[model samples]
Target: MNLFADIRALVLDAITTLVTEGVLPDGLNTDAVTTEPPRDPAHGDMATNAAMVLAKPAGKKPRDIAEALAVKLADDPRVASAEVAGPGFLNLRLEPSVWQALPKAILGGGTAYGRSDMGKGEKVNIEYVSANPTGPMHVGHARGAIVGDAMASLLAYAGYDVTREYYINDGGAQVDVLARSVYLRYQEAHDLSVDWPEGSYPGDYLIPVGEALKDKVGDVWLEAPEKVWLPEVREFATAAMMALIRDDLAALGVHMDVFFSEKSLYGTGRIEAAIDALKEMGLIYWGVLPKPKGKAEEDWEEREQWLFKSTDFGDDEDRPVMKADGSWAYFAPDIAYHYDKVQRGFDLLINIFGADHGGYVKRLKAVVKALSQDRVPLDIKLIQLVKLFKNGAPFKMSKRAGTFITLRDLVDEVGADVARFHMLTRKSDATLDFDFDKVVEQSKENPVFYVQYAHARICSVLRKAGAEGIDVSDATLAAQDLSGMTHPAELHLAAKLAEWPRLVEIAARTHEPHRVATYLGELAADLHGLWNRGNDEPALRFLQDDPVATQSKIALARATAVVISAGLGILGVTPVEEMR
Candidate 1:
């Protein structure tokens, strides 16, 4: 049903025929050949670089190869005409029936119109939103969560076995600070005077945790010293924070398949095992690192430390695995976490990190490469910051989250659908501005609303036709005679529909879910454009004079809705059947 792919196969077949006839060299590599929509739509329906890619290898001039290939392509019934463009590019105008039959293909596929098998069921592990279990997830975490979730969905749609994962940062000084903060809250719950220290978390979100702690063990930790209460309170507080984080993610429709604890890596010999695996490969060593740039010699101290030879595998410099205090560095646990992922037998690994973690990418990749022995590939996508706006002014931060707006705050301000759709409007690496005023607007300026409206409008059309006793069932519409669909506007929409499968493969391969949003916007625009055109040209209307003609037109509208539904489903957005 992929017209572009079908045509590309035809182009390859023609090249094969040429080689068999000895018109071209026998061993010319045609892997570089590509067929795509021409940059200028006026030129042709599709364009290919088959001739240009083969000319030099075949020992022939570009024009000669193109002219010969054009004749071979023009002989096919699907190709209306094949003309050689400026050099060796072959522009093809497909038969009108090819585009006209696309609605039938869409109806045949239903919402699975653009589903692909490009991934071949390869296992892909996507780790994202590994926010510390010390607090609720903030806006930056929301961006990474949405991106990773959408990417997992996209890959699943393209036939990858995807597992969404989250790494909990619960094994550090931060958890201890969380415990102390909760201890203060526990004292406050007992009506005792407490001074909130500088390093302790002061947010009121921990009030419930403190109350729960008091309820769990009444007055036992009240008179205890730091050593006795720290461990028990740390474990309790970490679990409560994780529960809060889970709720925050649920509110935004994000759920993880696995929640890996950094603390689990400790006391389990997992970190040591990961490091030992690297050491066996001659990558781990004890060495003195050069003083960091931009620091004075007097301010810097030279010390021998355990290090990973990350520079051997593309990092800017070797990275330390242990600190001077004889405790593991932050990178040490991360290495073990990734090694666990590799040992889990995943074919690919993807990590969605905040833009602030840019410097950690190279070392992380190097560690995974050394651990997996280059068998598994790791891709890290860094999501940039999100600035919120409301009523033409910057939105204020949430008091509950203390330093930033919580994901719950965002989901409350705008529904989960709006939040998810707006988060994907920009690429992961680009800064995104979420404006409340613009996103919820019912006009074409809002992409989510516009795309949803197209689906809803199609539903309205179907309902109206059904009420009028037009028999608008898919079976009836799919069998209608669509030969009369000859208008340029009608064919243009079908052309757009033909690109859905191609778009799916491109977006999945690039690991870019923003491309799906962009394609949906374009598809919505085309549907809206044709709907408006019907106002002037009565013949372009979906409801026509002849019953079969009306069925054909409705088929096209239903097909557009079908593709829109599929695209929105991949984005994890519910397709609205009716606009409010």
Candidate 2:
């Protein structure tokens, strides 16, 4: 359950009662009221601006409103104290019993402890790692995959019906290039000497696809020209590359709910339908764009082109939907893809694109806005570059991926769990430096290990308690007198656990998965702090002389473990039952 929401409801009910009794004005909007964690823990457990926001509207001093609100709030059993602080901010101190009951709530909720219904089951489509199906996914794609997949998970946890999708860029000329590259590999598989040209994909990964092609067509396509083999070979090669990509994603624990084909947009009337949707709004026209700023005027083309009036919708300029040669431009298919998402009845659309696609963001957002008539919101998260290092030096590229390090290579070096956790340690917009040696190092510098170590430490404690014949099961722990957990160190951990539901709402609403990583790190720090305290004071240890005391201490430790597991589950990382 969301304790913060419950407190806010209590605060609102008190305000409404105040209005009904004519103690305050009848119509002060309560929408602006929000309950949040105090900026400083020293201030209070929770802070609200209800009095401050209503002061001017009610034609009363903020302190007057806060003083009146405090009395009503303190009457609630959950609120230990409500004091007016600063400029009418109400600081709330919840009772120790409320914090003591958190572990019981965690145990009762299991992995669903912090799950929220904020999104109210709205449909959300998240498109990510739509890299060209030319080869296996690389390091850049890995970041997008983790970010997208984690986002989907986060939204689902927040009660949004999320669809994890990958868009196959198989309709473009890039697939034709891939077909030619595979054809060269096919010749080499037949024992013919081959040289990979500049634009061809030259990787050992394609060697097997080449062998598969030989087994399929035998000598028929072997002797044929590009006219006879290009179509069949392109189809075969695209399928092979997609298989490799799927396998790469599988290795990292990513499974797409849908793999939308870009080729389907080409043959179907979808593109026309999407364009017509925009055109009906008077957003389509034939026009000449202003010369791009800072470029040579001599190279600027003033020729008229079929363009979408994207400028009206906040684009820098009206963008071309059709090239001069009458073929659909790259943006055309993209608009159709988004239109397809909107047509699927999704209430929200999210795209996880690489940093290189930053320029495409505004136009694509405009497209979704026009297609959905501003009824749907589109959020695009740009994943910046990930720089890899080995032994404090730059990591070399993987030959298997042709030009970059493959996701498989990273996962193989550091298992999927580590890869996913480390990838999200940084914000999606910030460039990340991933060091292979540092990530796997069993130290505080390695956040993945730090958090996992905390979980494993709790497991170690539970095992020790079990051997000592102390019943540490949930049923027993729930019955423990947690009020005995009064040590400052123990209380600190309970405070961290109390923030879980609030943190989930913030991270989910912001669509920022990095917040989860940061919260886990903080939680681990609190867990470690308590463990260190136990080393100094034996009474703080999980295994006390008294079974009841041990259960009380272990209950808190197990509650921390429960929250960590729940957070990691949302990140698609398996929690370590024990550190190896």
Candidate 3:
């Protein structure tokens, strides 16, 4: 089904034949040989650097090997022509029938045409959007959620067993501040004068949590001291915030398989166990770290503390595990959390962090390497900022979220599909501008609308063909004669469809789901381009005077729809059936 892959196999077979005929030496390593789309389409349909890679090893000139291999490749029915370009590159132009058959393949396979088994069912755990359980999820967290969710879906399409996770950062001073903020709201509910402090969150979102606290305990905790009320209020507030966060994620169609609480690491021996495992490997030590860069010398304080020998694993410096106060440092719990994931037998670990967490990436990787003894690999993707704009101006904060824009607010303005699609228009590490007007605009420049329009247009085509008394069923269309589809416009679309399986494997391998979005945009453009050209050339239209010819064209349109649906599935987006 993968034409590029099939063609590459043909190339390898030809190389094997060259070896058998004694034209090429035996024991030549062909692993470096690759067959891919030529950088310039004019060069040919597919190009390989086989001759360039093997000439020196085979003790032959590059041009001599390329010319010899060209003859063998041209002998195949699939290859229309093979030319030796430049000094050694072999460019092959496949028979038009090769691309013409893609529509049949797409119709037969449906959305499963591009699915890959590259991961081999390897278990992968991806932790993302682990915002603190102190407030509603902001737009920043929305980017992480979309990227992480899309990545999980992408890996799954590539045959990886993926588990989505969210780490609850509840065991910190911020949650304590959240508890005090809720207390103020609780007092306000009781008609008592409450002073708003500097460090407390004063968002209106917490008002409901405060009222709930008042209804639960009445006046029981009204007279209780700080020590007595702090723990209970903290637990209550944290749970309420978590509930709100869950609702926000649900609105955006994001769901986590696991919600790990940082509090669970404390008083549970998990942190100590992870550290001890590293200690047994002689990675744990006591040391004083130097003053860090980007800080004034006077602001730097030196103290001896327990450190992890992360530098041994190529980290810039050894990281501290415990403070001088004997309490676990900030990095200790994270190490333990990832260590626990590695011990659970996950083949791969991925963390989706914010741009601010870029500095933490190296140390986290080092610890996972040491903990897993280099058996498990850890990958961290840092999502950059999302800048929101509307009406040619920067968007303001959300009153519902108190200080910043919430995920729900964004979804309310634009539906989940638009938000998800727009968020992934750029790479995760690149700063993305989310223009409300542009995202909802029904123009080709707006990729979200453009891609969706292509799917909807294909649906329209199917409807019209069905109304004309043609058998538009998938089985009927797939069985049509595709040899009539030799137009350049039709062939161009088929060629793009052939790239789907390869694109999925590439995106999955690089841990970049944005590539799927990019491919979908390009595919949509090609589909649209073909449709627009039909205005002048009546033969290029989907519906024609001949039922047999019409069915063949519909088969191509339906095939395009299938790939579009599959691509959107990886992006966690619903394919549009009709345009509004």
Candidate 4:
């Protein structure tokens, strides 16, 4: 039961009545009308812009329409008062019974209380954390993983059929480099002196791959030529690195539904087919691109090559699909990959990329648009950097990863729950500073702990009420008369609880999972505020002398806990029943 949505519907109904009764003109567009919380809660419970948005279109004064609409809205029993404020805005105060019944709605719905059907089961593919198969996932990948995973979960909760995917980069030159690095380690396993090259991977993680290769092949490839050994070693090393990466992601509680291969796009007719689809649309051509700007004249060269007309789709310049050497450019296979996704019939495609990939966004979108003929929408979210700190000092790099901090290192330090929750405290496009010292703190300053503590506090309340011989089950509390929950604090918390279903729909539509974390923090604050107030006011306490009053208060607390658990579940964080 979304009270805000219900109120907005009532407002719309009143506007329709006004139009039918000749108080307002016909054919007025009401799509711009909105109902939301008033800026200052003292003004009213909810506010609407119905009169402001419709006055000019209906050829009427804003105040005159607002006053007439107020009279109609006030006739409803649910609306205690509808007063025109600010030139034409309608501020509404709902009856206490509306807020009082919210707890029963929450208890009835449980964790599914905030689930929405906004997407209507549209198929959505979210691809993220497609880290290179040459190494373990680093800190940047961690942020993208959490954001994408949470987004998939959020969209699913909002009734989207979501598929979590990762695109493996094994077809690139990096995998060849990984093959050579593993060959050096294989030589080292044979007790031979191997000189490490400047571009070779020096991480100790590759040693095991080398040892495993030696054990399997038994010096057969030790004396083979580059052509014979390169493919075998590349295949072997890629598999091992992917396994390591899977372990790292599992450590951070991220699992993918699909792992697409970049190599699969090569040698197959897929690349040609994707380009042909664009060619049929007159988007592909053989032309010479102009020399790029800002480069030295000596570095610039004009060459006729196979190119895609990406400029027509709002890109800065046309992008090449093939080079002069007859080799596919980096963007060619990417276009083919996204074309494969479009062919699979996903209604929407979402790519979560690191901030460094900002330049690739426009070109990628252009290809998807040209291939899908604007039928499919692609949304690219760029995740900013994460700077780690400990004890007020910048954290150091990991030797195991050989360059940056590994995702496993982060999960080991803070655990999966803390890491996932903290990573979502900021938006995907905003830079985040993760301080180990601050995140694990038990104080209210730590949002994860504060929210979990609220849930734990509710559990403690239920236990206390149970020990006092009061029935505290959801079935019992839901049947109790909650009219005694008339205190302002009690009603405010219930009102906040009513916003969950609305917030879920908003977050899903915006494709922003951080809003869930933000709302959960606000809800936790309300729960904590009411719990603290009970210390001085005996009537506010959960366990009261009267069984009916006690059940009503416990019902409110349990409802709040239900929402907290549901929100944390979307974030892939486990809510604790008791804080240690």
TM-score of each: 0.98, 0.97, 0.98, 0.98
Q: Give lDDT tens digits, candidate 4, residues 471-542.
A: 888878778778888999999999899888888889999899999999999999999999899999988998
Clashes (N, CA, C under 3 Å) per candidate:
0, 0, 0, 0
Give all candidate RMSDs, comma-separated: 1.2, 1.5, 1.3, 1.2
**Candidate maximizing lDDT:** 3
Count of backbone collisions within predicted model 1: 0
In angstroms, the error of model 1 at 54 is 1.9
lDDT of 3 by residue, 1-580 (tens): 7777788888889999999999999998988888888999888888999999999999999999999999999999999999999999999998899887888888888777989989999999999999999899999999999999999999999999999999999999999999999998898889999889897899999999999999998878888998999999999999999999999999999999999999999999999999999999999998899888899988998899999999988799999999989899999999999998998899999999999998899999999999999999999999999998989999968898767888989999999999999999999999999998999999999999999999999999888888988898888898988998898888988988899998999899999999999999999999999999999999999999998989998999999999999999888899999998
Residue-level lDDT of model 2, residues 1-580, one tens digit each, is 7788889999999999899989898978999999988999888889999999999889999999999999999999989999999779999998888888888778767777888888999999999999999998889999999999999999898999999999999999889999999999899888999777888888888899999999988867778879999999999999998998999999999999999999999878999999898889999998888888898988886888789988878988889998788889889999999999999999999999999999999999888888899989999999999999998899868877767899999999999999999999999999999999999999998999999999999999999999988888877886777887777777778878988888998999999999999999999999998898878899888888887778888999999999999899999999887887
1-580 per-residue lDDT for model 1 (tens digits): 7888899999999989988988998988878888899999999999999988888878898888889899999999999999998978899999989988999878876767888899999999999999989888888899899999999999999999999999998988999999999999999889999998897888989999999999999999889999999999999999999999999999989999999999999999999999899989999899999988999999999999999999998998999999878899889998999999999999999999999999999999999988999999999999999988989899867989677789999999889999998899999999999898898999999998999999999999889888778998877777877888899998999999999999999999999999999999999999999999999999999888776777889999999988988888888899999998
* Shift in Å, residue 377, candidate 3: 1.1
> What C-alpha lDDT, on a 0 to 100 scale, does residue 217 get in candidate 1?
93
Better of 2 and 4 by TM-score: 4
List of clashing residue pairs for candidate 1:
none
